[model samples]
Target: MTAVVNEQTSYLSDRQCFAILDRASEDLQNGLALRAFLASIALAALRPEEARVLRVRDVELVDDGTGWLMVHPQAQERREKDSDRAGTVRRVPVCRELAAILQEETTRRDLGPDDAIFVLDNGRPLTAQVYRKVWQQARAAALQAHELDSPLGRHVSALRDARIAAWLRNGDQTAGHILAVAECAGMSAPRLAERFANCLRKPTRDEIPWDRLEAALALPEPSQSTSTARRP
Candidate 1:
């Protein structure tokens, strides 16, 4: 007979999720290293080890016009799975909130393409161990301040799990979505479902304010308005 292991786990609540992000954001503002680390996880969806290898060139604003950030894993050699094959790259269209955060950090640090995006106070690159320690400290501080119930306690691994959970809950039910998130996080989809099944919630359709949309579309079209005004 084969032995069986039950390894199911519960998911963090919405309040707990917000508390964690809130705490991480606070810690990020205190220093460049912490901010870069937090951005790696929250925005780039990078694992701690992968984040450790991130250079300034790995990330870029998608276009001069769009406020979206693009994460290119190709710059980091360690992220490559096969020695013969180049590392995979993907573009993540970040929301304005995350874009603003990156903008501030980039400006504050004067980051360049060839520089290491994350570095220690002594101007050294962040190591995997140090990244974990900093994440733990931030988690502990957040928990102590809010007294929130975190299923994974004060572990950086929990943040990865939470990101997967959030992605699944966002109505990304396709295998491609699951696989992409799993691959980026260096985990299997079955493993993710096993660990975060409880966190999967049905997506709710949010009501769009049509009035606001109409008002935005109603803004004058300069070329058309001018042409019409000059019509004979």
Candidate 2:
């Protein structure tokens, strides 16, 4: 389906994002379909198509506790989307928390690099249709009715939208950032910005520079003599 331009203004808050991720990451009993889907989008800003087709080979985990997911043409036999064009690639970083989760899954299945990262009971790659169904069920479990109805994480793509919007609001939306996100989303910078405007409202607690705020307070308070010097 074609996108509904400006159709949503309520992207996931940090709290909501965590709420969803935490639930999805709970256990393999319920299944990793939603867990992998949520982690792929929430952690890396991967589009639905890109995330669904992700293979173990595309994941690069560093010994230094950082990792990245590769979204590119090599993941497929045929071009899946614009970003899948020959020579086009985006390396989406995976945070420590998400990395640990992925590592656990990889170890559990003893998967080779060529295997699918997110799989099913029979150990098959998840299709987009199944991913969306799992997403809805997971959302119902993780979110309240109002939140579920809201644009926040409404579609799988919204996770990518929310992550990029958070980056922008956190004051990291430089040209380089825009270009990187544009590559991942397969859209121009302006288009990406316009679509995610709603999610770029007030900064979240994570975005605030608490260290800077504390540093300002650490400055010595004015003494009576110092105050007198400034008097008219």
On lDDT, the leading prediction is: 2
TM match of model 2 to true structure: 0.69
Instruction: Give the runs in model 1 whose Cα sits over 4 Å from its true position.
Output: 1-7, 10-32, 63-87, 144-151, 176-191, 199-232
- lDDT against the true structure, per candidate, is 0.56, 0.69
Candidate 2 scores a C-alpha RMSD against the true structure in Å of 11.7
Best by TM-score: 2
Give TM per candidate. 0.60, 0.69
RMSD of each candidate relative to the true structure: 15.5, 11.7
Q: What is the C-alpha lDDT profile of model 2 across 61-86, one tens digit per residue?
A: 99987798787644442453333344
Q: Point out the worst 10-residue segment of candidate 1 by lDDT.
A: 1-10
After superposition, candidate 2 runs with Cα above 4 Å error:
1-8, 25-30, 73-87, 198-232
**Model 1 per-residue lDDT tens digits across residues 1-232:** 1111134543444455445556655554335557556655655455565556556665555554334333444444444433222355545555555556666666767878777666765677666676566566666765544333434545565554556566666755667877665655545567665665665554455645677888999977679878899989
